[model samples]
Target: MSTLEIKDLHVSIDTDQGNVPILRGVTLTINTGETHAIMGPNGSGKSTLAATIAGHPRYRVDGGSILLDGEDVLSMSVDERARAGLFLAMQYPVEVPGVTMTNFLRTAKTALDGEAPSLRHWTRDVKKAMGDLRIDADFAQRNVNEGFSGGEKKRVEILQLELFHPRFAILDETDSGLDVDALKIVSEGVNREHAKGGMGTLLITHYTRILRYIKPDFVHVFIAGRIAEQGGPELADRLEEEGYDRFTAVEA
Candidate 1:
């Protein structure tokens, strides 16, 4: 069964310009153990779709439904959505000055589990996740994302992904601002998670390079505020060859 489903979703945000619509009747579904990729040009509503799924306050869902594991997601609060097994990896991770990584992770772990992990077990799990991501053990003591490089911040997000082990994840531009080495590392972490059962992913990206490392079962092209095209991996190839010109024209 599909773990995540977005049906005829309509999203808009209040801007000085007006009620700017970002997603217009967007619909998609991702089953467990599958990876779906959403590709689009700038202002095509890809990121807006991701943020809406994550319960961002600014991106209001004017219509349609989001379901996770057959439950209504639109009714859930942001933290409730997280606890209900949905994760979003942001393009721009915020830095916290005083909150250490360890503390932040522990809080998240506790919140998701509804109980605290024993000290010994918690330490072991945290160590294992960090090791898998090649993050140093000492990094847990640093403030969350503070003074971290772009690659490092992305790794931290992946670390959270591993820790949360959500049923589904929406990675919004996770490959952006990464060097070759960092991209490989991030893709490797996502691969590792997918190798485990009961996890689906929706990877929102503009470039096809990241798709080379993380092959998607489905590829969707978004233009304006709706899907312009969709298919298998071959769809990604077509986009690479033709660019977004055709889709943009359709949008127009």
Candidate 2:
């Protein structure tokens, strides 16, 4: 089974003022077939943790370690991390102006698998996955995220999650801006992948609505870049009702 461990991770971002600390001693472990939800208010260093795991340059690893199956993930480059089976579905997936969805997905899959999938089967697989996500058939021809609605863009992110089938998926606020129907659809797509097993998940979000659908095995309440509390599904229910006042007040 695969395992991704974050051990006392400390991360910082460069700012006009100076290097600003973001993730301070944040640690968590996600093993194959497990789902861990990290929920907190905005600016609690949630996305910074995700971006750091995915090796975004702006976020510098100031201290601590991230290990994948006992190998050092902190040393891997962004693409290398992907090849190592770590995937991050960003909250804002960028537009690739010249890249059609088909080409982008195909290219990414090829790079990850180290072999180009056969055209016939690849086409069929893409179509089926798209259909599963309720994506329009014509999106294959459209430029990636170009002229797409916010919900559509988020659905495409889930499309990548389904198609890539990574060993671990770090979804950063995937439910943001999605309507109830879109949220359910995206959550179901994630659930489909989770059901396949050997897929670890770290779902980060401000609200607990997605948890109602995705159902995390553990719920961690993050405050000021630290895990202030942890519990089972009931924790999520509590957060939905009580909000983050307790956590944020503690941070204050």
> TM-score, each model?
0.97, 0.98
Per-residue alpha-carbon lDDT of model 1 for 127-169, expressed as tens digits? 9989888898989999999999999999999999987888898
How does residue 162 of candidate 1 score in lDDT?
84
TM-score, candidate 1, is 0.97
Best by TM-score: 2
True lDDT of residue 129, candidate 2: 91
Task: Please identify model 1 stretches exceeding 4 Å from their true place.
Answer: none
Q: Backbone clashes in each candidate structure, one number apiece?
A: 0, 0
lDDT of 1 at 239: 88
Error of 2 at 50 (Å): 0.3
Regions of model 2 farther than 4 Å from truth: none
RMSD of each: 1.1, 0.8
